[model samples]
Target: MSKKEVETTGHSWDGIEELNNPLPRWWLLVWYACILWGIAYTVAMPAWPGIKSATAGVLGWSTRAEVAEKIASFEEMNAAVNAELAAADVTMIKPGSDVHSYGVNMGAAVFRANCSQCHGSGAAGNFGYPNLLDNDWLWGGTIDEVAYTIQHGVRNETDEARYSEMPKFGADELLTDEEIDQAVAFAMSLSDPEGDGTNLVGGTYDVELAAAGAEVFEYNCASCHGEDGTGDIYQGAPDLTDAIWLYGGDHDTVYDTVFNARFGVMPAWGQRLTQAEVNAAALYVHQLGGGQ
Candidate 1:
């Protein structure tokens, strides 16, 4: 028997003839399989967009529900520890105790989630933010103090917030430009014992200008900053004696602070976080080696 000849397409290019060929059975089967799979997938999972939300598939699974369930599990696991932290007195929790350790761990998480945005991941602080790892606290560094500050915040709008207003000597016309310069010199002298008013390099003190500036400081700044420039924590006056500065410690920076003043604000965590979270954050900060 002779084999049947395949027919050529009606159109041809040059001398070449084209044959219309059917798709491979295997290829067609695969294409059909894909279509069926897509239909099944649409039925089994959320695939269509709706006016308010996505379509609820037969499986009824939701990413939000999954996240909620995980959060529930985490809360369940930490319920007892969180309860203890909420109830325990922040001052009485000794450093090496289990509760203290737990607070430190949990507080670290809280700090990362919330405080890290301002204080940095390691709490080293940015230019305006205060460092947490050091012994220089604008407010008192005691555990109770730390807790109180965290709860009520500093310069926040809350009634119980730690509030202080640094008078802008230049802007407010409280001090002449020359007097402000003298005040800056005196403030610098407090931190730099050997610094002369002429140069910041540590050396023999500039007795003459320092003496002059001291009078200026005593007359204007001593009310809140203390006669010795040790700063009154109760008044939120930053200690000038320490070289550590929330703003820069350089002469220009000091002049700006004296002239314009600084009023940094911290939000009241008590309004945002639960009592246990607040206590944990306080404990974590207190244990960071700066707490008094």
Candidate 2:
């Protein structure tokens, strides 16, 4: 048979004729394959959106289900370690042991998921939040003490919560502004003696003002904070001499702390975390440089 001539559809742009060509067989086949694939995918997997949920396709597979299975597996894997941690005494756990290491690792994960929101990812706290890495602890820094604090929390509604309330000297009219200022000055003298003393002989404080402030402090703050300002752990009174301030250590910060007072609240974790988790977190925190 003679070769057939290709025909033009009679459409022209700038005197250039366009050929009436059918799509290539391979391209047509590929396009059809795509259409079939789309239909198959819609039937075999979740595709259509519904008011509440997507359509559960024939495979019955779901991403949420997969994630749940993964979590269950993880829990199962850690079950033995968690059991050991819960049974062992927090103080008895030997440092550098496998169990201790596991607890620390698990504790870090738990801290990241739960505690990090308030304490920060690095456990370095902000203005109100207490720094976990520091030596200054309002409650106590021992492993058992830390565990107890984690379990019971601080100033929470829970009965076992470590509770203390500093009197609002300014807000409640317990102390005049002058007295509060004097107290602030005295507190600063305790921490920054060099700056607050009159001369090189007397350290950094104004001896007379500090003396007056001392009288005010003795009358109001000494019961909980101690005469030397060393702080009493049982009362949750922070040490004023060390210069580690939860709110701040400056004069203004001291004035605010004395006048308004600070009431930091930590939620009771006993209800939220497992006993093992609480112990593990305590161990992890204890090993973080400042743990007594």
Candidate 3:
């Protein structure tokens, strides 16, 4: 419409007035360009919904194809290393070779992400969690056991997982700390039963307390750890009399043990990794020298 014929309000509220000017030539051209671009884009790209699907795009690009291509390239870059790992057993994935070290490092990363919460940074473990670094093991410390522990886990509630339960001493009110200390000291003493020196914590092993603790032990721990504290491998119980402690052998550590019960669990890795990867980790831990 022409400006001369256009109607406008002479009076305006808040000093604002309506204008009769048409849009600029460049502005109208840009607006039309945008409309054209929209039509072109709808045809050339996957923008609009359709009965079957959106447009395939001028380049025939798709999100699924893009993702698959990226993955293919990534796998291609790692092809040689993956091939080497697939061929090698867990035992062969040592720290020496760059290829083997890569596998070990990768396995360590996996362990840190999944296993470190309980097993600790160095796999040192807590009161209940078994120390991976130590020679002492509830189940056999072979490559099979290590891999099994990683894959099926410990007390993991999985069908094939290893399961065990340490007796709740203080919870059951079976033994007082003083009495438990006596038992702990006695157990520690048995580590070197015929040694010349007296045990550091021998004061705790009073005859009365030992008697009380022994009664408590017989009542609870004996069923799994055994009357002689030799432990039952079938039940995955560690020998209490051994100097090797999964947590620690200190008085405070033992007190913590009796005061608060310990129940450690490992996660099942069978679903997370292939059999080859599981075997690799098993051999890695086993060769760390605690292997049976």
Candidate 4:
């Protein structure tokens, strides 16, 4: 437009007039549309905050409610199968059956969510955690036993929890350092009768120490660990005769175990997971070739 037609805001900077140029009509219309949409959105969905909670919008729509609806639908779909699983005896759930298939898949899901933190994703286990795929069970390996352990857990506050405590022979002064040394030597020798008192990782000890340790083990550890060092499942004592060491079978590790003792805790899944979930987890673990 010509300078004569242009209206100025009655201000000048260095003799340049300040033109009162309004924004584009379309731009102003879009801006007004955005403000209206925002107000509508606030009214139609959960938005404004209050003292105790957010305001429930006019539409009463919420993300949490949507999630709850989805969960309810899924639970309704699986209710029948889950009820059957919860009621069924885990031992009698034969392989390749419908319930067995459901249980295995469900158990795998449960194990991934609950057990995989300590036990590996593949149930291989970590240091101080028992491997679920192995036959070397500190507790019994039966399906029923696995279910019970999952329900009550080990070393937990639950009254029915599996409980056991090994003496800190060296740390507590229940045994002399020499006696502990002997006991460690004997424990190592249990797994390797022909070799010198060697740990699983090839750390060596005096085989001579084992002979004296035999008496020490018999007098002190035999009651819980068994006379032959095979371990007692009732007491949750680990088998010294096996290469499957939860806390490592190395010489120093063995000495540490003998000195301070090892105490590993598994959570009572029954308190967390549903009964059907616990049952499925037990069933899946039982058929993994480790269960007795």
Candidate 5:
């Protein structure tokens, strides 16, 4: 049979005649290749959706399976290091060993990613955060204590957590500014009293101000700070009598503390990391310094 001619609308513009056009040879070939490639790809790799599943393909490739395999390989590579960490006691992971250094590096990663929000890069906490580098710890600084704290955070509102509350000085009306200042001065005096050797050497303390501050301490602070200005650690209170200060020992530092109570918290790591990682982190923190 003869082929019927294709028809076009009888219209012409700009001296151009409109004609019915057949599929272009190049375009048809490209479209054909795409269809073939799609079929081949579906057969070789996972593709095509079903009611409840997808075609497995000849290679059986899957994103989830690939991820799992990668993770498995990584775990295998670190198997020996993890075993060593698990076998050793926390105290043994101090500053001198290879394991100690590795643990420190790992712990630093964890601290920066998770703990750095509150505990500054140097572990020097802010007004509400406790300085981890310092010896003064609310819960405890032992390797086990550090580990426990990481596992069960503070005020975590969970079963396994270290919890405590510091009175809001100004909010609770616990002490007036003048009274707080006096307490602050006394707290500072515990470490360096005016006219004392440390104060004289520093030349920062005011004699008359300290004398007035002493009275404030006697009335408002003596109860918790103690008569000799020695803080009770059992109460989660810092020892002002010591020269070392977690925040700062300067006049302004002391004054800030008195005006506003400081409440610090540590999140529990137990939920976030494997037991092995938590143990390593604890040892790492303990060895940072001032660990008892």
Candidate 6:
């Protein structure tokens, strides 16, 4: 075929002619189709941002609705087990039963999602958090007690939450510096009956100081902590004679605690989780060898 001469637009720059060639018909058709599709998509699905909220498309599609539907489906799948768990007494749930197995599995998931951050993934706990694996318990350790604690929480906003407040003897000036020192000496002596008194917890003490502190403890802390510092479950007091310490047993730490006080807060799971979930978590935690 002979070469055809191409026309140019009536415009030039630096003596170069500008071709007046139109785009290929197929390409033009596809471009127009894309524009139409985009307009349809904008009308059928959410696209524009409004002042307060996004424009609701004609199709009524929503990400929130989709997520809700997914959650509903999952809930439906577990509905039977959840209902059974909610009604059954956790103390009576046999270890080898189907409900028990399901509850323990579900509880593991719940603990990982909600309790892991504070109690650790293994539930071993941290310096300030109570170890769930040990026999030591600030409150009671039975499955029923565990469920109650989870339901009400500790030192939280809920009306039924477990409440206890340690008096800041140092901060409130209830005890003189010397008397506070003596009281700390007495507390240390409770934990270590055979160790040297002067070298306990990187601090020094004397027999006379401990004797004086013993009297002070009897007068002040005996109400909640018990006469021997063994603690009272009713008062939510930790056993002072044990090696377990929530914060630390160091002299400075104990002094600061006596001066200021300690308050730990836990949210009421009953408010956030279903009764089944609460029971499941309690059952799982209670069987971890810590529950009484």
- Which residue pairs in candidate 6 collide? none
- Against the hidden true structure, what lDDT does model 3 obtain? 0.68
The CA root-mean-square deviation of candidate 1, after full C-alpha superposition on the true structure, stands at: 3.4
lDDT by residue (1-292, candidate 2, tens digit) is 9998889999999999999888899999999999999999999999999999998999999999999999999989989988999888999999999999999998998899889989998999877898899888878899999999999999999999999999999999999988887787787677765554532222243456666798899999999999998899879998888757777766666677887888889988888999899998998888998857
Candidates 2 and 5, the one with greater lDDT: 2
> What TM-score fits each model?
0.86, 0.88, 0.58, 0.87, 0.62, 0.84
Best by TM-score: 2
Off by over 4 Å in 5: 1-68, 76-105, 122-131, 193-206, 212-224, 242-244, 249-253
Task: Write one digit per residue (lDDT tens) for candidate 3, span 1-292.
Answer: 7555655657677888776667799999999999999998877877877799886878676899989999899769877786777566554455588766766666775667767787788877776676778777777776656767777987777899988776677778767766676666555554446543233433133344454466656775678778888887768877776666666666567667766667777778887876546655665566556647
Q: What is the C-alpha RMSD of each candidate to the true structure, in Å?
A: 3.4, 3.4, 7.2, 3.2, 6.6, 3.6
Q: Candidate 5 residues 55-113, lDDT tens each? A: 99998889999999998998898888878876777766767787877777778777777
Tell me how candidate 4 scores on lDDT.
0.88
In TM-score terms, candidate 4 sits at 0.87
Tens digit of per-residue lDDT, candidate 4, span 53-95: 9988999988898999999999999999999999998888898
Residue 152 alpha-carbon offset, candidate 5, angstroms: 2.5
User: If ranked by lDDT, best first, what sequence of candidates would result?
Assistant: 4, 6, 2, 1, 5, 3
Q: Which candidate is the best by lDDT?
A: 4
- Cα lDDT, model 2, residue 22: 86
Model 6: worst 10 consecutive residues (lDDT sum):
198-207
lDDT of 6 by residue, 52-84 (tens): 988889999999999999999999998998999
- lDDT of candidate 1 at residue 154, scale 0 to 100: 93
